[model samples]
Target: MTNSENSSGSILQWLGFRGARGGRSVDGKPAFANGAGNVFQQARRHLLDEIAAFLLTYELDVTPNNLLTAHGAFSGSNPALARKIAQHVTAGLAVTQEWLDEITAADETIDKHDGIQHLMARLETTLESFSKNANDTRSATADYTDELEQHVAELDQVQGTGQILSSLADLAKAMLERTRKLETDMRRSEEEAKALRRSLEKARREAEIDHMTGLPNRRAFEAVLEREYRDARASFDPLTVAFCDIDHFKRINDTHGHDAGDRVIRLIAEMLATISDDNCHVARHGGEEFVMLFRGISLSEAHKKLDGLREQMAERRLRNRKTDEPLGQITFSAGIADVFDFSDPRAALKAADEALYTAKQGGRNQVIIAPKGGAQAA
Candidate 1:
């Protein structure tokens, strides 16, 4: 038998099912096979059925990327990868739910930011008014003091008690009016300062969140990473960082449109959030990429977690709801490195990037751990 025929037979034998050979169905569809055919023909039919089932179940488009991703997930030796694929396939639903929550929170934050910006502007205007009024009050007070001193001096030289008393009363009334105006300005200024303090707090929160994914943005991530790195070094604690990138993300954008691409980004972000815990921090490193920080975890532990996540990502079949077309499987490659192994944070990130490069080169949907020493500059 030919290699194809031999392979077919082996697969059929492994499945414990015979192949069908004799009949044609009325619809011109080959009669459903019930175990009778040449090994090659049976194998081809079985493969076709499996492919159809996969497409139907996942609502995936019959694209080359989807085919390859599905084949890897179904038959790959690593069970973790397969399970991960399954997780990815199911991630779309989870993404939808998680996105709603994030969008709601995001909307609330945006509103607060808007409100604070308005308040800050008003406070700025009020403070300016207060500054002007305080200057005016000081000048008025100086003029009033001079007038009172001159009136008293005049009163001492004059012969009438009524004139001196009248001047004294007028001076007292003028000083009391100036004191009340100053007090009002001071109170208004104090309230404006309080509002400004609140606005600053809101501004800080707005700065830290990524507008697209609602995850911590790179700037915030860097601050947290630096602090953690410093603490880990001092205490000799386990700290690991992973760099992750989506496979064929540009192709997805080109093929499915930008809206679909956005969905993919949000999906991945939600997935990361779902998998993370209090000890694990997740951030969007930028377009189609992410970074994860695992505190109190060694390189091996981080590797295991990321590998599973990678597998899950591979299994996810992204689709465009508008066209009802499968966008194809979403897969990622990742690299993990121990923080303490590197001399600095940048070096650690570089090593993780190199390991990620290796993973992508090896295959588009796996994880690789960075070498112990560190990664060389690319």
Candidate 2:
């Protein structure tokens, strides 16, 4: 018998189905007896009914190989039937592989990266037109002023007729009124333009900053780190990084609920922003963690600044809103490392993480410094 048939037959036997020709009845009928045929027929019928139910429910495609494998695995206990099922499974997998290849090829034909460039070019053109319009508006206002002045000079030089002088005065007043309306319209237009520009800038800034903390997010932090690293390399200025982790953050969440946890995070974020220098860029790395980049500062200096911030945080008295009782103080563990020695921002972060792990291991509320090329402290 073929391998596929053998596999299917074994599967059928394992599933408690008897073969058609070799079935020995449980009532002690001879192996090759005609009475065994009746039992095998009943088993085959039941098995086929199950296969039909499965196919109907699953809505499987009625391929010849699938049908044969399904039939053999359900009713036949022969080794050859089992082998056929295995071969059919392999063929089915090959078909799926071909389908995936076709889909991927079709996708690759249409996928391109030119849309972003086109959009940027279009934005630039729009900005240029806006600028030109502004210049044109300014020139038009100046030209109108010059014409009004010429009109005034003409009025002064006119013949001594009171009616003509009065008529000219009325015409000049109407012209001035029209000019004032135009100026008001122009101011409104300029205000709209300024509003649009501010909206775009606000969107860009929001994209780089964390929504909850109002600090730089991970993407912005990475960009700033690269910039700082380049600056440090060129000027040989000291650059340090501090990896800060809030202590027992999970415990706080479990004990006081996520609302309290969020409040604590926001409070810490505000305190960090207030304590850090303007040059220092603080970012919410992710979930109860923060990163601080100190430009032109030594590791010791960074540690001192972080230490003070930690103390300030620990001293703050946060209370339960309903009970008026203390909710317990929040503390953070920090790790400090120099940015100059690390090859990449991630490496510097890893150094700081190592130090943070050390701090956590030692106790939970202390700062640990990872030196340039030394073992982590405990």
Candidate 3:
């Protein structure tokens, strides 16, 4: 077969379709069945059930993006992501929207979606223009007030002026007072707009960051990946991406309670951060997972470094200071892939994630390197 034909066949699996097109997706029926009056309610119901399960399971907010996210996880492409979520379900770990956002962050779509960021940006632009116009109008009104005051003075200077002059003076005073009020209102409106613009900026920054770890969240990482991918490919520099998961973290939470679990999570964050530098970027990718991006690094070299960290972590035993209860050895498993080897960064990320699963299945506390340029890393 031609390369195109091979790619077409492989895309079916990559896109979570089984057997052939217009057929099973993820499970039994096709995902996203054809619309335009097609008899596909059974498939529709199945997909709805999957969406509902995700919302109800995690108590996630009912939003269109959340619905789409869940659908993609359970019914659409990336069944591996669905499987990973199932593991969390089995472990009884708390699920957060942040976690879902992180793991599914590999969707290689551009930021063309109509979202709050675009909305806020438009609002800011409008407000800035409005504020400038308001200030300009205020300044013009102030100059007009000065002109009005001079006219009133000229009327007073007229010798032996009658009642007409008195009426003109009264009218001029009224106009002056009204102009002052207009200036004050315009100034107030400008200040309010400036304040709102500042708030929007702050909100935008917060949305891209993880509140728990104060690190770049999945949404932020997605932007980073896109930029780094371009820079890496252009410069012909090797870029490595890895996914890491804390081994038996839910057990830690279950045995020692959430407080201890929080500490363990923080400790892992710190340990991972030690490896971060200008060439390496690390972030908490939601829940018990962290993602790292490395530029100018080889795959096996990155693995050697991360694997060494894993061994050190495995050798250390922790304890809960609250009750002084002993906690078993804490360690993390990692899966890594070189970005240039894959057709795209998203494929590389999925491959790395599959390797992470191998590390887990092969017994945790180790790092696995995926085969070059393949979808199934392990």
Candidate 2 wrongly placed segments (more than 4 Å): 1-198
Clashes of each: 13, 22, 0
CA lDDT of 280 in candidate 2? 90
Question: What digit string (tens of lDDT, one per residue) describes model 1 on residues 232-278?
Answer: 88988899999999889999989889999998999888888886786
Could you tell me every candidate's TM-score relative to the true structure?
Answer: 0.56, 0.47, 0.54
> How many clashing pairs does model 2 include?
22
Winner on TM-score between 1 and 3 is 1
Q: Judge candidate 2 against the unseen true structure and give its global Cα lDDT, from 0 to 1.
A: 0.73
TM-score of 1: 0.56
Superposition-based RMSD of candidate 2 using all C-alpha atoms, in angstroms: 42.7
- Give me the runs in candidate 1 sitting further than 4 Å from their true place: 1-171, 375-378
Better of 1 and 3 by lDDT: 3
Worst 10 residues of 1 by lDDT: 14-23
Quick one: how many clashes does candidate 3 have? Answer: 0
- Screening candidate 3 with a backbone cut-off below 3 angstroms (N, C-alpha, C), the clashing residue pairs are none
